[model samples]
Target: EQKKNITYVLNGTTQIQSYVKQLIDVTKSWNCSDVTYTTVRLEDFFADIKEQALGLVEIYHQKIDWKAEQSDKKVTIAYDPMFRAVMNVIQNAVEHTKENGIIYIDAKEQDGRLTFIVEDSGSGFTKEALLHGTEQFFMDDTSRNGEAHYGMGLFFAKTVAEKYGGGIKLSNSENTGGARVEIFFLSSQETS
Candidate 1:
């Protein structure tokens, strides 16, 4: 079934082909099983994520008003799965954002913890969504209307963050007027 879908896209219009290619690349990142923690540079991690975000924004037909900033930092982490988590949330942000919306990516390491933030310019999540958004299969209208979403993105992201001695925080971005999510990861030791 997935192959059929891929074939169809490959045979479709140029935009569809591009979107499918981006989708496949992003999909591959999610299947990473290497959970070991190792020292990694923050700039390298952000560069990878920003590239993925660029593909996602283009595929989603959003403008490239993206920004990424980080302080001088280095930390040990299972960056593969964490990259998947970051991509998933940024995709979610794109889904909720209006056309030509702005998305912001910021990160910093402070006091032995690394904090990654993604905020967008869309209708913020409802209060209920902010509270239960991380629950498995919990989709809300703002992020997942009648789409194929299983509501597992944020749930899996939270799980990954937690498994690494960190957690996720969701809230409305007062500045961007959209949903804001912060993923926190401890740099000291691996939890599992």
Candidate 2:
């Protein structure tokens, strides 16, 4: 039996609306039934997500620092799932970071793995967040409440990565004192 405080909602309507949309996206990622994997050019994959992320960041008045190495490479991935997973990671950054905050995204292949790193210029992960950030329904909010903080973003990303024999590592970025989330996959070894 809870209700929104009208005063708060009225005062923060725009921010709350943006948040609701993000929550909707998070909810949409819960379905895995139609996920299909395909080998895609690294350049295409990078460009697609970059475009999407940039659009979202613009709405929030934020910035991105992108670096993609070896864009000519190819990798087999469930395009949408992985894309949404990566977006979820980025969106997490976008949501937590304040206005004008910068997110660093890097795509690179090394040691036979393809990795997408997303770092946020937000308060770094809380001790609890670092330990269970990817666990289903785990949120670091002290209140431990709110549909907006369902804590599924990283979990969904982790699930998608694991399906491809990869995983996400969470840590505080030494350069920014922010959260760093790296999702990696075993390279397809396709030299196309």
Candidate 3:
């Protein structure tokens, strides 16, 4: 019995450490100068984001549905940080949403900015959350509803946006009755 218990404890510890390492690997910080920008088509980029979102939802067993709209008009964005920010938004939606929730992702270019919008059918942000969501280590129980979140997702997204000449906006979507997060990236030329 003593040996069996020891084996079980070791296994559990190993699993926990592995999980933590995986999480760290996903959200590792990047220096702004280390990121290189290259021209890429917007539709393709949105498709990649959609794919990543779907995979995360499935992995976490969030039971959320998603719809993605790809821009028909061709446009290019050169900011590499956009990918990390957009992924964080989608994952945030997945984690906050309850079962059977829906997430909407839309990408478009306007006024020399490429905007990516993610809306989740979850309890929208409280006023406090809206105000401080992007602050590092800021988490409110009312907004996330006791989810296993470290509150770094939005902060990282905000950093990515600010580093690339854009910003992040958080709101409650009137149409979806849920949380809406918009991340904008500067135009290709402005990105560099």
Candidate 4:
């Protein structure tokens, strides 16, 4: 079946604004902690992924690589939402994985669509959880260990993906005992 047109302008605009505000608040609170904010570039984002992985290693003495596989096709998306989508995926991977766990990212274009896959080597979720993963405030109490996750990350990411005539899917990771979140972006022609 063709993907549904999931764009809701009012809802999307509100979510995007809220997410941007949260990101800005967090960055401002860092003050002078060597945190750098710049236009989101693929390379720079990957660098931050590496840095976060290294910090996780330091804390848990684990080693993992957070690298996105190379692809020939390049698509320029809105910087803010794309960055937030990627950051949310990375944050989820870090939060859910145990020490020494691995997270893998792969990007490619297939069948006229660009795809990004984020997978982690953590405990996998139940089928029910996967089904409802994109619902706002629909956190699985069993999965969330009393953490203060807003549970809106995937919801907003899915919103942004749909706004771009794309789609997002959550499933069990085939390589790891963790979840895999895939974001798909349809070409402009497809949208037209």
Clashing pairs in 3: none
- Scored against the true structure, residue 144 in model 3 reaches a CA lDDT of 64
Tens-digit lDDT track for model 4 on 1-192? Answer: 223334566667777787677555434333444323233334454555457556655675555655463433334445445556656766676677786677777655556455678887777767777889887767787783345465677776776677656888889887887888988655422221
Clashing pairs in 2: none
Better of 1 and 4 by lDDT: 1
What do the candidate models score in CA lDDT, each in turn? 0.73, 0.81, 0.74, 0.63
Q: Rank the candidates by lDDT, best first.
A: 2, 3, 1, 4
Tell me each candidate's TM-score. 0.74, 0.79, 0.76, 0.64
- Residue 78 of model 3: what lDDT? 40
Regions more than 4 Å wrong, model 4: 1-74, 110-112, 144-146, 187-192
Top candidate on TM-score is 2
Q: State how far residue 48 of model 3 sits from its true place (Å).
A: 1.0
TM-score, cand. 4 vs. native: 0.64
lDDT by residue (83-134, candidate 1, tens digit) is 8777778878887777777788776666777677888888888888999998
Relative to the true structure, candidate 3 reaches a TM of 0.76
